[model samples]
Target: MLEIITNNRKKATLKYVRAFLFFSLILLILFMLFITGVVIYAKSKGAPPLAVPQSTLIYASDDSLIGETHYGEKRYWVPLDEISPAVVEATLSIEDRGFYSHHGFDYKRIVGAILADIKARAKVQGASTITQQYARNLFLTHDKTWHRKITEALYTVRLELNYTKEEILEGYLNTIYYGHGAYGIEAAANYYFGKHAKDLTISEAALLAGIPKGPTHYSPKVNEDGAKNRQQLILSAMVENDYLTKPELETISSQELNYTFGSTKERPVIAPYFQDEVKRLLASKLKLDQETINTSGLRVFTTLDPELQSIAEEQITQTIAKDSEIQVGFIAMDQHTGQVKAMVGGRDYTESPFNRVTQAERQPGSTFKPFLYYAALEKGFTPSTLMRSEVTAFTFDDGRERYVPHNFNNYYANDKITLAQAIALSDNVYAVKTHIFLGQDVLVNTAKKLGITSQLASVPSLALGTSTVKVQDMATAYSTIANGGVKQEPLLIEKVLNHKGEVIYESTPVKKQVLKPEEAFVTTHLLTGIFDEKLNNYTRVTGRTVMDQLTRHYAGKTGTTRTDSWMIGYSPQLVSAVWTGYDRDKTIDLTAEKTYAKEIWASFMEKAHEDLPVLPFRAPEGVVAVQVDPDSGLLATKKCSEKARLTYYVKGTEPTESCIGKAEITNEEAPKEADEEEKKGWFKRIWDWF
Candidate 1:
């Protein structure tokens, strides 16, 4: 009986063991299937692009914020190489000690957290590893719910499967949210220390590492003691992880740190007009896509000089009346490189989004005469070339139509005058005679060669700037003349960098020889005649209003029309263009409106050159500067001391007149107007331009 009972008990025990082992196998299979399904679902979802999109950032030449394109906000992404190694050690020690060993989820940590939760009878401890926390920060909200936890588990698995450990860490470091609208490690570093992440010391890195746990409560800006305590905790953890010694932690904790206190504040849009131009050029010049310009996180290092921009704006504000409806378009450029340093599109950007500099096309008025004069110079016309300045009508198209041009205020010399005298007086009749003599198409072609892109009609009025041109194009055209006949396309952006800090584009200075160097210098010299009162004939030279205030020599022209007033000028180092007029072609009847351009140009040039060394317009090779009588264009002598002026000419095109007194502006001795060909004869006379 005892043996039978022993056998039955043995059988019972064996049966119970078999049942337990079978149940364990079934449970393992179910668990495996559940994990497989979770992975399949995660794969179906894939990863919604890991990077948060940001718009391109624009910076001035000095690396300050000029403006941004679209919706980028303040977050900055830096590679792991740029991040401080101490930040990594501190974060790993405190946030996830088993980060490297864990695949995605930490089961051991989960079990421990569960035991702790049961002990407190409340859900308190978290089992998130670095990977899990990254997944949650990127994709989900931090709420205590089983549904959220399951979703987080799927994301963490996806991150681990898709990216490597280093990549995951980089993404986490870049995308994690810190306090006070600081989003990434780079931005946080800039905000707190006014420095880059790569420059952070171990102590600074520890302080930053502590912020993510409780951003508001432990932010040094908000709670100094809390931030200090949290930093100490992270440093102690670093010691435990063998990343640092206890003594090192104590020393770091005691070290004093300086905070920047001022950084990443709300930036006002600077050079709004220039920013618009950068966008347009980025598309047209570089072939950058509109979408990329808006969201590629490009770091556009532009050529904007903030000090000059401020001066330009101030000049406009001070010159134009506060209540005036006149609009202004201005641009300042480096003559040598064509880098646009400053620009103001309108008086108020908010009131008018239209960019007058690049968008508006208006008549150039007398400013157009420079091209005509330059063309004449190339055709063997000298500064002493004689032109009869008087009211004259010319017949063209078989004498079917007559076009007569008039000077400002209908003033004229009504006698034989030199080219320099005609330019100084802005004599319209002489300009028309020269325009007619040059076959009407010469001035148009010359303007195009100088970089004017706007359409120009090859008509007699084209010599007078009747056809419209953009201000930027006008500046570029003059830059060619200012740089001694070399064309330089405008440069708004010096270099462009993509989100990964890879150079995408760089400026190469579009330079090409266009005008004859000697002839160009003569033309540039003629521009100064507008400011020289000694060249004054029937009327004051156009720029004489600001002549006394000008401390240095400048090559410039002033254009006046029924609607538009223009001032475009250049020094050896800088070129500036200013346009002021009504937006809708209303006649600019106000004297203030007409003088606004000149005043602004004068003020801007003087203040902009405050710290710059005085640079003279050096004469190029094959060019000769001669002191001549302003009215006769003859070589200067002691007898013509007060009236003599320095003039530039092509080596062979200079005047051969002896040191003799020329005819003065007197109604008594003035000669009658000469015929068309005779009016433009090459001889001794004066030249002046408005």
Candidate 2:
């Protein structure tokens, strides 16, 4: 009976062993099939293109490279032979010991890592080889998930099968990111040592190799001690791997490494103000955030003219007063296309990044007069219309306050002056009178149509430029007049190209007709009177200092408040605005000193128009010029003096009555006009008298 039991146990043991063997074979076959399927899928998908972050180039209108925008990773690709062998050996020793022998993974290291993780009850160690790291950097994110790991494994197999060891290492070296806005070994070498990768010493190579593990924590700029310790650890690993002898390691470790830091001074950015504006416009146009703009590898083509921009910067530096604590904002735009060619947000961009051109809102002073005068023109008031320039007080509806308006010098004309003379002299009383004569809402609507978007007060002071507005908006509003009644949106970027140089976006000017051609011409004609020597007598005129510098026909206005000074002018082709003031709204005595705004504007405009053709302001149809009396705004007769100036007027609004000076004022027919004026209300009588 005992022998029978032994035989049965042996038979059962053999059967159980056979069953275990069969099950193990099936499991192995399934695993092999799963790997085969993954490989097939990866092969069908093909290797992903290397997507290392690259620097975005910004080109000017002339196609010259002006600036570069980049994410934290700035890379320059190079071949394997271009890298030093010392770096390759050091990297291999510290990162993957069995890189040369492994197919796609190291099972021994993976098993050891798994055991260590199990003992620690957390994933404290990683067993990723160089191939795995390359796979992750190439095609996967650093997300800790089984799905990502499986995908990484598949990509690793694909990498190993598709490229040789040297090719893989070259790609790995080119794709790894270093710190301080550097990616790839070549960029890292140049950024840190100011040399090529092939010229690196063994110590430098080991130091660079140690940085790929943790770029921020091991950066020599951040922690020199930590970087040196990590470098020593890499060197010891190289010694253990037989890649370096002990004596060689000791000699290399003893040598001090020289490093160069990346700074703006080293790589100067050209047209920084314009570049920043382009970035902001690009963000809005593409609906992208700052991070995406820095990293998406876009090629931005801007409307900036490098020569013009340089001229603008130089002129600002030369014209701004040295002893003043005032800041300035300036911008130039093409009249027709509204392309912003040059912009200086402040006197010094490095001192403050606030873009005053497009960002800051300040009182525009007398610059708001043009819009009010334009509103008057729309209300059938000709440039030849006469208004009183004497002191006028406007009482509020509640009778709580009264605004008494006066001229800059407190010296009113004390007589009726033509509308053109009011603008030329910048008479605040006439402006306030016109603002009250025309509806307040009419002025606001005209301002809005002309591109003044800031909040405006609807009081009589609105005509005196009491509203705050951006310098850029002022440029646009003046550009409308320069463009002959057409309003075009301000444009900064011309086009945006993708990484492959394909045009992804192109900008076309958005235009709208906001005024009658005749009306705009009349307004522009009125503005030109400010620079007229006959009208100004070359004295006390706001822009009189720069009038001699103009070689072509241009119209402009000078605006001043207690804290601000502005000069906005434009030719047929270009429009520019210059604003000078203290940033903290400190009171400035613009009347006590020479106007820097006009000086800067004149300097920049003179330099900007040097090579361009001298274009004249073309008169549109339905506009007529008539010689009018300066005092009476009536037709010039032989009795009128030589001061009668030829002024532009709409076809039907030209003065018909002749100016006979005091004789006609006291004529026998004056009693009929007085009897008719006495029958009207005070407002109607004032309106009809003008």
> For each candidate, what is the lDDT?
0.85, 0.84
> lDDT tens string, model 1, 223-287?
98898888888899999999999888788989998887445544567999899889988998789
Residue 676 of model 2 has an lDDT of 82
Error of 2 at 643 (Å): 3.4
Tens-digit lDDT track of model 2 for 423-532: 88888988988898887788888989999889888888989898899999999999998788899988888899875457988997779999888889899988888787
- Top of the candidates by lDDT: 1
* Model 2 per-residue lDDT at 492: 85
- What shift in Å separates residue 349 of candidate 2 from its native position after superposition? 1.9
Candidate 1 worst ten-residue window by lDDT: 681-690
**What's the distance in Å from true for residue 460, model 2?**
0.4
Model 1 score (lDDT):
0.85
